[model samples]
Target: MDSVNFELANDGIWTVTQLNRQVGQLLEANFSRIWVRGEISNFTQAASGHWYFSIKDEGAAVKAVMFRGRAQATGFIPKPGERFEFRVNVTLYEPRGDYQLQVESMRRAGRGDLHEAFLILKEKLAAEGLFDQGRKREIKPMPLAVGVVTSMAAAALRDVLTALARRAPHVPVIIYPAPVQGMDSAGKLVQALQDAIARNEVDTLLLVRGGGSLEDLWSFNDETLARTIASSPIPIISGVGHETDFTIADFVADLRAPTPTAAAELSCRTRQTCLNQVDAAFNALTVSQHRLLERAGLRLDRAVACLVSPQQRLQQQNERLQVLKSRLARAASAPHDRHAARLALIRAKLAHAQPRLPELRNELNRQIQHLSTSTQRLIERRGQRLKAASQTLEALSPKNILERGYAIVRNEDGEIIKNALDLSVGERLAVELGQGSLQANVLQVHALL
Candidate 1:
């Protein structure tokens, strides 16, 4: 067959399917996977678990489909009007030749890149032990002043201010205004941290920003800023982005808070709560002191009551003096009369008992002689009995046996044995003579009945 040549013409009519198929082929052949950034619209989640949506920007729009398998793997689901950045494979449906994106994964736009970077930095710092709990400095309970590094006009700054006002208004805040985002933000942040330290304006510092896209929060991930935060003499609290967004500053800071308001809350003491505690303690102390004073006062009152009064002592002395005076008066008036009366009574009694007195004296002398003789006999009997007991004890003494030329043979331990069976050759024995003891080892032993 002869080769046929045809010129490409733009006017050739084509069916809708043919056009779409051609477009699909071109799309598939040209692009395999791509990244797209746009606002989500016309979002629909079907019962079949697939997601169909349109991604559009100011200039263009494209249809997107996420199969159930991919959709389920994505950690987050998109809502209408939400901006997203996605990785997708571009293809065309041959039936309609419709060009569309088959999404594999999706995330909130600028945050996706920042989140990835944050994770990488976090892992690196963790491996170096920089983010270890042991390396983190403890925040002071009550800082005298605090330095705030953020954009002065940011809502985060305003939130921090309001929170501080509510929690600890007395805590002085020195604002170090710095751009929180964009190209040179990291440098500005480092400068702000160093400036606050140089000025010594604050004992603690707060590096904070409101929630935003990953790109919006890139300043916090700057290596220089991270190093500055790590080496800061003043303790730092990092509150960047939202709770879900973590930054390098969070790891290097002395403390991490989820929000700017939380950072402010951490930076200062709750003055009201502290005051309440102080008041409670003071009241308790006062009560205890009052109770102690009352007890002491009562003790003093009791002691005073028990003490002898001067008037009582004087009255006692006066009574004793009156008794002495009455006795002296009586003695002076009847001294002889008292003696005569006593003598007459004695004479009458003696006349009545004179005969009996002689007999009683004789009987008393006889009784005395009898008691003396009995005592002498008892002494002699006791002496004789004692002598007999002493002789008996002496005769039974072990020394007597030794004196009789009978030696006591005992083991080295001083245990005596009477039987020959108790002897063993090579065993040590002690022999007691009349005057001393001798040690001997048994040379031989023979048992005899």
Candidate 2:
């Protein structure tokens, strides 16, 4: 029989590229964006900033790729063997005819049903006031002893022991053995909590365990165990798993610590803190002692200032009398000494500036002669200036014009009459000539153009 042929059509032959392209389009159109949860593996990044990886569960696996832009937007780079949920698009690689997922985004995987149960239980307990701050008791900052509830063989117990020994060695640690994992661990944990409370040997209790998956930490989420922790007379510190993990016990306990050792540390004051308090107290005492010493020294100085013996008083009086006698003697001779100093200053000045009366008299006589000559010459010069001024005035004088037959007439009001209208008929006028003024009367009303 001839080999069967899977061709595109009888009329036309289709190439491998054409077939792969058509299949890829069909796969892309048929499948919508989906979510896939699995463990990451074979993760690698290219220099071009693209990611290539495979996501697998227990049985199946799929090749996935995230482009540079989408990978950058995810903000997290996935490592091999880490579990994450991926959002992807199903498509075939047309070049190789291979089916793979194009990853859009990725997130850490959720805890599934166990996580849902955890949320429900947490909400229920919170609504019932189990997580209320008012219902929780305060853990003493300085406890006398700390009791731990954990399996003696577990690593959590060892972590708690190490922390207690290092931080608060003075506080005794009482270990109450209890199973920290498995299905039956919750019952044993409740019993241990109850026993610690009844014994009253410790003021604070630590309920701790190492980090694990949600299933491994499920025992601490038991409703009965959380209720018991909340009701404990001694304050409980729950340190279940890592800081990222929170069990029901964490909410129910008086305080929640991130780890087993941290719970133990919370049970009492640290050694360093106690040392700091001691140093502070010592400094306060030293300062107080210094203040007291200063006060005492001040009192002694005041007493010394007030003290005066009889001999010392007599010496002070004698010194004061000597000072008074010296002052009185100086005061008594003060007028004479001041007069003597003034006389000496006058004598020194007289000697420095000795006057010659005969020479001064001769100089004065010569000055008087010179002044008389100078006054005569000045008088002659002034007379010449006055003569010149008189000549100019004579040339510009109206008396000259008046002497040339021009007369200046004034009305009765003493105003010079320039127009005939200003001089009315029968008006008295003063006529000024070259040598004198004559009073006249207007006799006729003579009008002239």
Candidate 3:
């Protein structure tokens, strides 16, 4: 604001090296590891084992370096026009102040954008439940025939044929050729799938292609191809690439094989294995039949043990009848014997129970005589008692008392007057004596003083 301190500010000015170093540090500190996708250009492998290249998209290009350590790990030699995705570090060259990327690793554009698209479609179909294991149909272990969808020129077809011939030569193989690469390859693949399905000749369909770079294999990543595979009624075995490669078709298929040959091996059993199984089944059937015949023989032996001739059966029945006849004769004689014993016992009991008439008559006479004496005694005793009672009653009788010189006087109404006051003077009364009765009249009544 006052005088400019130009000399002082100049003294604080930073050197070029320091400035570039600080800027580089700042760039590295601010930007983490990043990803870049573009066509590779100006690629050179330095004698010092470093890769120098420029990655440019439609609008932008950046210098990039992959050191020997990272470049060798890529396992791919970079081509100028080829596209690649790289994981890189942001940095600036200290000397030139030029910003560039240090590549950590590289992936052929195979799993980059198309892989992302593949992932997106896979996730979408997965969410819609198209990739559900339950929705996938089972591939027949013993298919009647197999349909192949691939280019006739593809080496994968030859590999599949060799595998099927070696493992199961009897199984039929039908080839539906389609371009395995190029712009319209996915459409041809879908048409081939439709053709195989319409014919309905094969139980299993192999959708196969040989391994290639991601761009070369992009047809297998098509959404239409993936949808066609998912919707196909035939069980599809997706053998689109090497073991390390994956495509959208793999996720939607009923089965995914690492290679086309592997898909053939998975589809059916080997001829030797089939023969072994058949021989085992035949041996088991033979053993079962032998055991069954042995059991039948044992059962027949037991039946023979129980079998008796008709003559023996009749002889046994006759013996039983003879025993029964002897028992019947004994049973018939037992009642007569039992009756004889019962009659003997009854005779003895009757003899014991019989009454002796003479003795009974004697006893009856004796009882009658005793009863006569007892009756005479009872009558005499009764007579004496009656005489005594009569004497007592006569003594107690008023007539008897009158006979003893006492008299009963009655009033005129024939009531005995108990007191002299009961008689009125000149009242007539009657007096009854022991022998007679008399009527009297009271001349006067007197009160005893």
Q: So what's the TM-score on candidate 2?
A: 0.48
lDDT of each: 0.78, 0.80, 0.79
Clash number for every model?
2, 0, 1
lDDT tens digits, residues 16-44, model 1?
77666666666766676788899999999
RMSD of each: 36.2, 48.7, 55.9
Q: Write the per-residue lDDT of candidate 3 for residues 1-449, one digit (tens) a residue.
A: 12222222367887888777777777777664877789999999899999999999999999999999877655447679988788889899987889999999776675665655655776798798877899998999878788899998788988998899788766779999999999898899999999999999999999998998777888887878888888899999999878877787888899999899898888887867866775676567557656765675676567557745546655665666577556556666567877667557755755564445567557656865675576567556755765674466346444467798778787765555768987788898888787888888888888989
Report the Cα lDDT for candidate 2.
Answer: 0.80
lDDT of 1 at 388: 77
Q: Show where candidate 1 strays beyond 4 Å.
A: 1-116, 138-141, 198-201, 242-244, 269-271, 298-449
lDDT for 447 in candidate 3 is 91
Which sections of candidate 2 miss by over 4 Å? 1-54, 57-60, 63-112, 132-139, 296-449
Model 3 Cα shift for residue 446 (angstroms): 99
Question: Using lDDT as the measure, what is the rank order of every candidate, best first?
Answer: 2, 3, 1
